[model samples]
Target: MKMAPKGNDVIVSDRKLEMILSMKGGNGEASYANNSQAQAIHAQSMLHLLRETLDNIQLMEPPSETIPFALADLGCSCGNNTLYIVDVIIKHISKRYEASGYEPPEFSAFFSDLPSNDFNTLFQLLPPIGSSMEECLASDTHRSYFAAGVPGSFYRRLFPTRSIDFFHSAFSLHWLSQVPESALDKRSMAYNKGKVYIHGANEHTANAYKKQFQTDLAAFLGARSKEMKRCGSMFLVCLGRTSADPTDQGGPGILFGTHFQDAWNDLVQEGLITGEKRDSFNIPVYASSLQEFKEVVEANGSFVINKLEVFKGGSPLVVKQPDDAAEVGQALANSCRSVAGVLVDAHIGDQLSEELFKRVERRGSCYAKELIEQLQFFHIVASLSFA
Candidate 1:
């Protein structure tokens, strides 16, 4: 058994980790593709905003078929969530074109994510483009559109300037390009000592995370602005801090046993890995507060905020039935694993990652009923357009 060693001076750099990080792929039980209902649900709630954007966006000079309507889903995880949004956009625009007594424009939809994302699965889930809405419904497929995969980071430009008529992302933009350098530097005072995330960490550690998020968001908005048409808009939803409180995870506070830190702490106590080694590893995600998010977008100055709201989001992993309480822990663990297992594996090894999550699952199951029944989180839903 290869236990991770703390003696190594250099860990895998954050840039390398970022390149390889992606949601668990494939259709297995643990795959992000299967476990991403929470994300899809988040998108569903933003349909009103999406519809509003579609109504306002003018893509073609006369809305002709020759000028295909172009839209891109940034950070499109390996799930049907992107497809769902793409379908909605296509349907909405097609209806408008038909009402104007014009031939409905051909649609171009791009699914984008990191190079390591489960894009193969995402592509497989796509239906034949240009199918009628009724045909799509009959086959349990999505709406009509030409589907293309754009493989790269969204932090940089992925489309030609002023080409995309609509941009959509959901539950994805909080990921930083890299974890803060200070958080991983043991010699630095801001080194995250005990926690795997900034949630409940010291002020220095929390600030480091917040700064990184702001930087990445600036780059993201900058890139999107170049690609968006003058009248185009973006609709986004992301998991975020519910309040001004730094430790806030939604409203109920973070679950004790189900968090990544609990599992890491258990491993450290068992001497499977040194505390120093644990300190070196941190998940590169931030749940930005709405105020913090708006500050960045405002600072960027490329886009004007159209709609922004924070609301409580429900989790399917919550324990609803008395008979099913036992499964809550496993569900919670699976949810976390699906989103981050790859990063964990890269930081530690596959074996250590498995054991760590096992401890989390076991502990979570034992404390299932004691945990919050709602497991609600706050989602920041926003719509923005070029300034």
Candidate 2:
């Protein structure tokens, strides 16, 4: 893999970043739109939690009558998922102003992602302002909603200071700004061997992954702190592990890691990919524990935790049992391929992705019966207010 310098000293390669940004877009079979049902469900579950915060923002008196409610969704991928979130916010804010007998402020919602995201596809899917609402509030009728796509990585500043009133991110922050340098360095103690991530790795390798997550998360919080108005709130939902030990084989990372390792081993036996290539490749994801998440937020000191909760195994958001093994496997395969296909393709070459996913789908089918009973995944939903 080629390594290129980028960001604030983060050693991400230009090709890797480009592959991640540009590969998943549009509404094609491989697009995130078709594969992100679980993510959409998680985003829906957060709507109730966000209601109070949206109301509180409406209660605040704006410095001027014309300043619109500036809202943003970081890592807004191409789909109706983001539009669904925006609609929820618009509904709550409009109702609050109507109940208070005040004219509602206009909305300016920014959808942000890496530069290669399919903004064209996103705009085409978005319903015109009030079109999707069941009953448009009187305030909504008078006020217009302006939407724009702001292309950039959220690991750095993407907006002017104090410009945003509210922000959201879903299923995106778990990815580090870049892979840990030590993991890729042959001389380093953290050099991961024969596995893509820290799963089944030594203490040194695990800690290296943790350190990178901390650095990236801190940068994320710091940038948002500068961009948001005082008292502004952000709701973030991302993959998390129940275990404090990074090496524990208990989370979705382990599940995916096991499957990928098994698949690669089969491919190697068939002489499809070299052993060195398998050893060098690692997925740039870390499912942080609740404690780890709290530590990062507290250390940053820019936001106060309003609500911090974890939905563990068997949670509605994590487990959705399907009717049959084939259906279950196909759904899981679609979701995994949509997000991870780019990385896998980049590592081994795009020629093998279809065959790789086919093997993955077969393995996934065997687990359908088990998944029907329970799922081992968890999610951390955090609601924070600027301090």
> Best candidate per lDDT, number?
1
Q: Rate the local accuracy (lDDT) of all candidates.
A: 0.77, 0.74
Which runs in model 2 stand beyond 4 Å of their true positions?
Answer: 1-19, 58-63, 130-144, 313-323
* Pairs of colliding residues, candidate 2: 4-13, 196-282
lDDT of 2 by residue, 1-387 (tens): 564332112233456463365436777776787767667776666677778566556345654458877899998988878887877887787677767767667779999988878889888876545642233544334224788999888999999999998998978888777778899788988988777768888899889988998888999999999999885788888778877798863555645676656777666667776666666767777888888999999999999888887865332213344767777666656666777776776556555667777876687688776655554557788889877
TM-score of each candidate structure, all chains considered together:
0.91, 0.88
**Residue range with the least summed lDDT across 10 consecutive positions in model 2:** 4-13
lDDT of 1 by residue, 1-387 (tens): 234443323245445655888999999887998888876776687688789877877646463658788999888889888887887888788777767766676678899989999889998888765356546534545556778899898888899998999998887887788889999888887798877887777888878888888998999999887888898888888777666865554532353323557889888888788888788778787888999999999999998788888866776463346345457778777888898888877777777888988887787677676554546677788888878
Q: How high is the lDDT of residue 28 in model 1?
A: 89
Model 1 lDDT-worst window of ten: 1-10
